[model samples]
Target: MQESISVCHNQYILKPQSIESEELENATFHAKQRAIEARQTISPWKKSHSLYETGGWKSLFENINQPLNLSTQSKEFQTRYNESANSLEQVVESAKLPLCPSGQPEIGNTVVFGVVGGTVEAPSIAYLTESQPVTEEILALSDSVKPTEIFRIASSCQADACRHFDGANCRLAVRIVQQLPTVVETLPACQIRSSCRWWQQEGKAACYRCPQMVTDNGYSSKILQEVGDPYSK
Candidate 1:
């Protein structure tokens, strides 16, 4: 299952590249131009859920660098590396995006493309790199994190397309992976599951263009795929 998820991530990550290439091939000027602009900002480590840092790596490096360890003297480098990684994760995840260039969520969040695991280019920076994934610290961060209001915000934002239909159920996926501010809770069962555009259009995809993700742990191919392919939409 893990391999399948990773493979799924790889496929979705590459989809944008294929779409961008097709845009250029067909001479769709606007798409080609947009693709170019989008390409300029893509970053590999920007979107991966598995590549974040909160507290796990910090603990590991610190443990290894403990004064009681014989290798502590040489292991100081690990501490610096962990620190740098953590900082990078913070920058990539916390940057606010302009929905209308004025910085408001009412208009919606902007998504950047990202390329994970190859020389392939992306239209934005919402994917991962070949060598990036959550370190122990990142996983620890995931553990401590809670779901965000955007889950509901996004839910309410597109209330029309949601499947939790009895009028307020977020019924699409039995599990909506989000970082809320408290314990990992199964949000109200989505009654609009089938009607949701994300499920209907993206199918098992996460929405990375969401503000919650942008303000939290970076973007990922898994999320973008849910937004649907640009050409198709």
Candidate 2:
């Protein structure tokens, strides 16, 4: 008599290395501080979703009178501002991408709505500081595992002038993904920052906050959250 064996499929494991050493911890702290400063320089009205919801042809004419408190003298004013900020926060959260707690850029550099692996498990800022393993393991794994097709949402970036924008779609998922280095530099900068509706509405920098912004080249043991495969020996 012949016996049969059963196979079970599980989610792919992401073996990320730790940068918990003292020196790296200090570097991570400093890098985060600089990023925060850069964030402060930009205006808050730059999110595209806000502009789209508020106007169409006259969006440029509408007033983004949302004032921030550089100084807090009045309790009433503070309460109102806090309420408004919380409301906007909900809206922004809906549009923001989920990132790993360690600050690693999403693998494949894109996310598809129903896809499982697009999300990393860390808080947004901390994830940015975490280092990832190099991509050679994935390449080897790809020899047996077929590359999966992933999807990205195409919004108002059809202006033809955008680099990642192809006619009305993104070509980065095709072109960039193929050339994606084992260690990616900072997340890809918002190629569409200048005219991105989000930037116009929020008065803030374009997707500089995206986990995938191209901030630096490749991951380092001292810098980014590393990537690895647990199955490998």
What do the candidate models score in CA lDDT, each in turn?
0.26, 0.26
**lDDT, candidate 2, residue 54?**
16
Worst 10 residues of 1 by lDDT: 97-106
Compose the digit string of candidate 2's lDDT tens values, residues 1-233.
01112223411222222223233334334334433343344333323211122113122223434322223213433343345444665434424432211111122222111111122211122221222232333222222222121111123231222233334333332222232222222332223334334344332322323332222211212112221111111
Q: Lowest-lDDT window of 10 residues in candidate 2?
A: 223-232
CA lDDT, candidate 1, residue 28: 29
After superposing candidate 2 on the true structure, give the runs of residues whose Cα lies further than 4 Å from its correct spot.
Answer: 1-28, 32-161, 182-233
Those runs of model 1 whose alpha carbons end farther than 4 Å from true positions after fitting are 1-104, 107-158, 161-168, 171-175, 178-212, 215-219, 223-233
Clashes of each: 40, 48
Residue 113 of model 2, lDDT score: 12
